[model samples]
Target: MLNGHEEQEGVNKFEEKDGNSKNYDESDATVDRHRKILHTDNLKLQDEYQRLQQQNNKLQLLLAEYFQRKKCESRFSDECTDEEKERCYHNTLAKLKELQEECVDQKAHFEDQLKKLQEERQKTEDMVETELEIFVVYKREILLQTMKRHGGKRVSLEDLDRLQQVEERREKELARVQLENIKLNMRFSKYQEKFKAHSIGVDGQHLIDYEELKMENHTYNEKIEEQKEALQKVKKKISSTTHTLTQVKEKLEFIKAENLVKRGSLMKLEAHVNEKKEALKNLKQSRDSLWLDVKCLRCKSGLLRNVDLLQDFEDHCDSNDALKEKLDYLKMRYVQLTQNCREFRRKVQYAKQT
Candidate 1:
């Protein structure tokens, strides 16, 4: 039973480690995959950029030539003789044919480049998938090696804590690396967008032959008619806008007049408020003075006496009561003496009579 329990404990420990290793391995593989993808993407972009830059330069030169020709024609159109005009016209036609041929060649070349890029992307995806599988197998090998090294013993909590601390430090380093990766990704994305925009600017989807050219001319005429309609609409809009502006101007003038009247009324109200405030101030001052006079009257009328003096007056009243009691005793003594004297006199008379 004890051996069985020990084996179970070992299995449980192995399970915990397997879970951690799996998670860590998965994360590492993802990071590696991202790295490889970015590297391949960068290579692809470099090649594409070189090609596109060359094409752009050629297109720019062609555009410059055409524009230069147009400028020369405009400058000399009135002065040039018919033979010179005919020569210039022939030269222009030849240049146009050459430009059309170049355009066709470019379109074909671009199609080939597109095919190559698609194949490369597919190849890259396949390579990444295979590499991922290899990485997973490599991760498993490392885990097996780790298990061999650790043997069947259960990992202690203290050891796990130490490992967790180590992992935290590693995570900090990983985070810094991820930050740099993110910055690089941002730059890459910006470049990608710029490349896309550049490609759009020089798009090859235009009239390639005489029929298409004629269709384009017809479209231009239709566009001109649309523009004329748009211009009429704009004129109507302008007239409506002018009417609204006049109404706005009239309303503004009315508002300004009303504002002036309001300002006059406000000024009057403000003056009245100031007068009331001054009156209130005067009233407050008067009330304060009256309070001071009332306090002085209270003091002078002896309504507010000192506590010690009141106590002394009470003591004096108490002494006066004691003196009054003594006087009443003395008067009683005298009455008693008078009554005794009368009795003695009566007794003496009785003795004499006997």
Candidate 2:
């Protein structure tokens, strides 16, 4: 009887121990389920964050590229040569064409990515909703069981506050993400507007205008060259004329000096001729006196007949006539000299006037 009682007591103890172990196993399983669900939610949030980060990076890169291109254009526009500008323009045009093609490709790629992201977001949202529903159901069951065990006691106020805080944090994060998405969309719209503007015929029109301007520039350059050549010829002619004028001025000075010397000599000759005329007048007066003396002697011939004295008187008269003829010849020579001098002076004056 003692042995049977011992055996029964051991069996009851084993059954109690098994029941305790089963309860512990059940609690561990519930904890593991909650942990797994939280881990999956965290992973989904991380993936979404990563995707947004990648998109932001892409947008930033594109913006940087655009700003760099604008800076290059502004720098080249400031002070480069026409050839450099033309080269830059062609390069810019080629780059723009490439960028346009890239933009088209990127637009298509972005559209596809956006569609994919939207679908993924919808799927994630559905999954989160289902998970939330399951969690709610599990929480309700736990709460009911706790209430039954604790005779209707509510959860702690601190726990409720903590949950509210978590919910607020989640809402804030969602709002931040939505704002970022809006900013990205705005940037994309701006890029599209830029692309559209570039797609117009502005480049073609500019090319046509550039060609016309080049033609005009060539023509203008040719005209400038011709003008320069004509100016050179005019300058040569002016230099030659100036040299001739200087030579003529030198010749005129030499001729003027010669004329002055000749004028001085002519004046001296005129004075000498006037002196000769005065001398001739004195000689003529002397001859007249001698003739009167001769006449007086002839009247006294009957009172005193002296042949020698008459003959001497006749010789004196003949010598006086010869002296008078010589005076006449000198007077004619003086007149001729005066006439020649006057003629020479008149010719010199005429030459000076001319």
Candidate 3:
């Protein structure tokens, strides 16, 4: 009877341990399932973020294109024909209307999406809080059962440490997830603000009165006609100026060639004057020697016999007069050349300024 009781007690303890182990396994499985669901939610959020970013980029591009088109239309308004301008204006109006409609649709869709996200966030929060509470209660029950089985002895230090560590990790993870959700909400709000701004800009155009736009259009047409007339006059003036410029260019080229020839002639004249000066120096020296010879002859024989000396003196005087005239002519020519150079330079400068 004593052996049987001991066996029964051992079996009961074994069964209790088995039940505890099974409960732990089930709890672990539940935690793993919750983790998987959270992971999926994170992935979905990431995908949504990427999608929103892409949409934002596309919207920015469209807005930029719209502004560029508007600028181009404004620039060409005066240049375009009346019919073309009207067509462009109609097209722009049509596009604006379409964009307004699209904005309305997008706004509605975004509002719906926002509402859905809010509801989903609330549901997720509620579910997570409930699950956490349940998990805590389960843990407490397990701890109590463990203590009972151990006869109220202190729980193992390693198990207590592990439980504390797991709870800390879970709390940290929950905080991180909450932070992420808050950040996502902030981003959504920013997107909403942007949408509001866009809608306001689109609607602002409606404030302009139609009568005022018509009057402005009429004034623009009158201005365009005036501008066209001015442009035609400018074109005529440009053509006349171009013809004058071509003629001046031709004259400048001719003057440059003539100046080159004149410079060559001036160079030749200078060389000739140098040669003449050298000849005059030689003639003076010869005359002086001849005079000395005549004086010596007169002193020795009391008379001079050479008649060529007087003739040579006469010829030297004539040559000196000719050289003086030639030098004066060269000086006049140099002055004329310099004046012509100045006049040509002035004309070239005037042409360039024009």
Candidate 4:
């Protein structure tokens, strides 16, 4: 009986030890599974940290490149003359300050946008967590009811596998969001580069237009100066013409006064010539009367001499000779005066022709 009891005790102890060993093995497996999950979490964190560090390194390289380019451009600035350099420096400083202000504004706007995006993300996460919690609670109640109906039967393994697939799908959606964020950042960078290039092109075009406008303005100013000179010359010529006209008018007045004086002299000479012509006519009439008287007296004396009238006849003859001489002299003087009047008239007419 003791041996049987002792053997039975040994069997029980072995079975118990076997049970303990199985429990220990299961515990070890559970611990190993937990350790694997922890290692996965640690690896994920390490990868994220490495990615962040790489991003930082890329940003630093970009900044260094920008600074180097700026440094290289500084040498060209030294080539400008002092006056131009001073003006350019002031303008550049003003422009740089304006660009800095714009950048600051853009940064503030982007930060605000980021804050809004984060808030939206947080809301989405909360909603997802709430939905998950509700689903878990509902599933637990369904499981309990199913167990009650099936005398504690478990859910199907296929259903559990489907749930795991849904979880993976959610993880894929999160990864898609991350990829979209990366694409957006790249697009933003490309846009910035294009904008900078466009601004440079616009600035160059503006400078060219300004230079053309300046040249046009200078040309117009030259034309105005030429026109002003031409106007001044025209004014001088006009003044000279006006002065000449005044002189001509004065000369015309003098010519008119001289003509009046000459006209008065011509009238006096005409009056003298008319008086001499009248005296000549009177002398010729008197001569004709004397000839008639002498002829009549001779006839009478011839008759008387036959009857003793000889003395009277002699006296008459003497008187007739004296009268003849005086008549001749008067006729000569009249002819000379007539010739003088004709010569004077001829000279007056000639003077008018010249």
Residues 29-126, candidate 3: write the lDDT tens digits: 67667656765665565556556655655566577768787788778767768898679779977987887788678767866776776677666656
Strongest candidate by TM-score: 3
lDDT per residue (tens digit) for residues 1-354 in model 4: 124345345345434543454554455455455545544544454444444444444544455556566568777667768898679669867876885676577667756765665565565556545555554454443333223322333443444345545555544554454444444444444433433433443567756655665565566556556655655655565566457445644643454454346446555666776788898888889888898998888787676645444566667888888889999998998999999999999999999999
The 0-to-1 C-alpha lDDT of every candidate, in the order given, reads: 0.61, 0.59, 0.62, 0.55
How high is each candidate's TM-score? Answer: 0.30, 0.27, 0.36, 0.28
Off by over 4 Å in 4: 1-80, 143-152, 155-354
lDDT computed for candidate 4: 0.55
Q: What residue pairs are clashing in model 4?
A: none
Cα displacement (Å) at residue 271, model 2: 99
lDDT per residue, candidate 2, 141-218, as tens digits?
333332332243354334434444555555455445444444444444444444433434357865665566556556
In order, what is each prediction's RMSD in angstroms? 33.7, 59.3, 52.1, 60.8
Q: Global lDDT for candidate 1?
A: 0.61
Q: Candidate 1 lDDT, tens digit per residue, 215-242?
A: 6456655655665565565556556645
Which ten contiguous residues of candidate 3 have the minimum total lDDT? 144-153
Residue 198 alpha-carbon offset, candidate 4, angstroms: 9.8
Error of 1 at 271 (Å): 99
Predicted structure 3: lDDT:
0.62
Query: Which prediction has more favorable lDDT, 1 or 3?
Result: 3
